[model samples]
Target: MTTRHLVDPELVALLDLIPATAPSAENLGQIRAMSPRPPVNLAQSSTLSVSERFIPGPAGAPDVRVLFYRPISAQGPLPALLWIHGGGYIMGSADAEDSLVTSMVSAIGCAAVSVDYRLAPETPYPGPVEDCYAALKWLSTHGDELGIDSKRIAVGGSSAGGGLAAALALLARDRGEVSLLFQLLMAPMIDDRTSTLAEPHPYTGEFIWTRQANRFGWTSLLGQEPGGPDVSPYAAAARAENLEGLPATFINVGSIDLFVDEDVEYARRLMRAGVPVELHVYPGAYHGFRMVASAQVTETSARDQLAALKRAFDRSV
Candidate 1:
């Protein structure tokens, strides 16, 4: 059964433009090579300044590279966001999301540090997430220099980046080193079990990021078959038993996305654990639908995200 008819009329054309290609060792290099890397143009925005720097990574690991975005004319200690990029844990670079971070920094009047974490199949689980932690610690410790409010930091990302954000939030809570104000998870890929479900969602996982791609991504990141018994919660956040004491969360996913069920369940669990959560499910949409920038759903999603961030930043917590 095809879900093509259910797709938003404006987003239908995007399906043809982005063919579903599962990543594997054989074609990973080619796919990555073809992935778009939009240049970070500071000239386009007079109010935002962007700089790249290398911060110390996890113990014994290499230095993690990060991109910092700040409002040029803003004063005082501003709230901060640690932005992560999405590419199913296998690919994607912080530089690729320059426009995204820049937009948020410009609109929210906040500082943002985009972490270029090491990717998987090569670095894997703790490596990628630990790199994010390094960035967060750097951001928190250098508040005086970065002009950021250490107590008001938030973590966010799209897809795999969102997964890392969730994991990082949990890690921050457990480690007691840095605190988070909010977590913005946009269709986060947080469950390895999704790929191994005996009976998968019939209408979802049919476009953009499909079940096959999910399986490949999970396998690469885990360095083992997904759905196995010993997957760590840090690697796949849904594996975590407890969701308490974490910061407030905002999660949004397309109804037809491969991750809708997992994301919704995570939100429900977060609420049950006494954490504040905001969840939105967009209808007639598939994974990565936001790539269709002109689509109404994409516009709505962006607005919702920005509004949620504003509220989080404005709150006293």
Candidate 2:
């Protein structure tokens, strides 16, 4: 079926604004130009205060930039969220997501730190993930100074950032470095193999984030061919053989998203491994359907995500 017929009508109009040509190695600049830039006046709440600072990145690597959002009225040491922005691992910056990150702080009354990790093609697998891990470590050790409750920390992101968040959870578990209270994986790009598949579910991958773009993203982030035998779980969480020790997870994906199948399977694996898991699959929604503010699904997605984060924070406390 065509994307228009399969996707939510509101999402269909939004998707129509973008050209559908697949990104390739030769047209990186074209693809970057086509991607969305953060708006000058992001819709934000007055209850939140925003700040930016540089923090220690990976050992020997340069410093990572982070944006902090906190409820102005809240007292010290509140729950915190470490956010990673998504642009298929190759594009996007922390500042691009300031609106959403700040809204999260206002809604949950929690402090949020959005990581400005090094993008791929320049900094691949280990570099991006390590930068995120460093940010997580920084949040943990310096929670007191940052007015965050060390014990109530959650890691989350959208699309490629969600993929990194998932990978970070695994890295934290394996390295015994940080204890994450929860994970919010929103339309995550978690499987390099997603693009390698010989065939996809008939209804998926036709809308925003097509199969061609997915392949480009995975390749860019790996700095090598993706879906090979030697891929690391720290680079792609779906590559992890075990999901037993990860924190409580919230997985949500649009029915028509390219990553829907992988996200659902990961949630199933997390549940089977005895980890607490919450999964939501919104019907008729395509990739980033939540971006259309007027769509009913967008409101539902926001409500569900906020509720999940609140529950995670409350339980941690």
Candidate 3:
């Protein structure tokens, strides 16, 4: 049952670098403490200007913090990306993705907003997603001020962040507040039920992110057992009954990633619902394979993502 033999040879070394420890209430504090933070020299980027702001949060909630990245020399009215960071929805901050957002803004000459939404096990369900919505609303409403084009905005993220991005897309469509150009989901963790499946994928969930970790993360976010009948689509995008009218989508996942089946199924459903979709499944890969920055697969995935974002922006224009 070991999937170690199935992993891309180039990514095998990364297994030792990234521990497979599952998060539990007892060790969650230590995990959060060990999470990477934005570099002190984040503002040193010559091509991009990085700044932080406290924006209005969900009604009755504390203010949401966000990091904004903009190409210093870009022309007016650029496309923007509202990025959510991963960490199983329990850990991770906007600051952790400063470099990733900066690279995108620099490459695409677009504005980027990395949202610092409230984490779960404390905020729970609607709170975390609502914070993202508030950030999206703020970005869309203040587009002119941010030198971004509201019409060309996109939402994206990795892992739990991708799950939120998917949920946010559904929320935006149903609420009729914002029009998203596209959604970039990189190995999105969208199905709480994946952790509860009667027969799990033996090849997937054996690496960086396992079913045990997934269940812990989902339980933390829901404040209850995951895969329950009452799960909300807004909480778990895969629970959504309708994928109609969602924005064009770009989804990419490792063939052996824990969420591969769910991600692929979501893409198929989107296509069936008439949403334009582009999906990629890289072989011999597992969840978070992008952490192996030097690997060819990582490079390919990053290139594909950048190209898709650029294309989405171009079409918007």
Candidate 4:
């Protein structure tokens, strides 16, 4: 129930820019068949070589899709990032984020490996997370062959991708597997219980993620219900009571994002647990606000975020 009068000019403009009708379920197959960013078009750039393959997933589990973004200009042993693309873990592919991964490789000078893990409504909890773990494990195990610096590797994503990264960081640490150098999370959907009446706020009310979408995503992820008993912290990060021993984190969230409070709380817990964290909370911005190209703040956010990540990678490398 966002009142038109209460909306910001940038938000209004971005809303106007959106297509009136998005592809529906019935049109998805047709659209994918005709789309330019399909699996075959995995290498979206002539300047980069996009390697497509199926990486082994969790033990006894199915394989997961993965795409590598290696810049043509970059030489051997490039720094790498295991990126998980965000679409609420429902709809999104590495091809759709080709430009994004390319920008990261060019801007940060790090090779990017984008993971197209299993999505929800088909594969539930531990499915996507396990897929991401397998990808990371494979990345570490084969780091030398890929010409990536194993010690400088990081994990990142926006929204659901961020959620997966956070979970992966915890899982990686628990398993004593890869030593994660950095985690870049942008407006992540880290919590499934955000729609609780006990935590009502202005930020939670107006964002594109309504209470309904949260319910749908969480239900799909959990395969039964959301905000219920016996939810694991790895599945929904906000449920983690102990936040120690995670990797150094860089998080950027809009003040108006629905998960703003949870992000703030997570940062606080991370700090208290002696985990170094850098957090940026932008005002008058909503979740996915960085996607609005016409919005000056959105573009500014992109620049600042990219610069921060580049700095982090430089130091980590």
Give per-model TM-scores.
0.98, 0.95, 0.98, 0.89
Going through the candidates in the order shown, the clash numbers are 0, 0, 0, 1
Model 3, span 40-147: residue lDDT tens:
355546677888889999989999988888888888899999999998999988877776777788888999899999998988999989999999999999988999
Error of 4 at 89 (Å): 2.1
**How many angstroms is residue 74 displaced in model 4 relative to the true structure, after the best TM-score fit?**
2.1
Model 4 poorest 10 in a row by lDDT: 19-28
Q: TM-score for candidate 1, please give it.
A: 0.98
Pairs that clash in candidate 3: none
lDDT of 4 by residue, 17-69 (tens): 54333333354445435534545465356577778878888898888889887
Query: Clash number for model 1?
Result: 0
- In what order do the candidates fall by lDDT, top score first? 1, 3, 2, 4
Query: How well is each residue in 1-317 modelled by candidate 1, as lDDT tens digits?
Result: 89999899989997888857788889999999997687566453667888878899999999999998999899899999999999999999998888778778889999999999999889877899999999999999999999999999999999999999999999999999998999999999999999999998888999989999999999888889999999989889999999999999999999999999999999999999999999999998899998898899999999999999999999954
Global lDDT scores for all candidate models: 0.92, 0.89, 0.92, 0.78
Model 1 pairs whose backbones collide? none
For candidate 2, which ten residues in a row score worst on lDDT? 36-45
Better of 1 and 3 by lDDT: 1
Write the number of the candidate with greater lDDT, choosing between 1 and 2.
1
What lDDT, from 0 to 1, does candidate 2 have? 0.89
Which consecutive 10 residues in model 1 have the weakest lDDT in total? Answer: 38-47
RMSD values for the candidates in order, in angstroms, are 1.2, 2.0, 1.1, 3.1
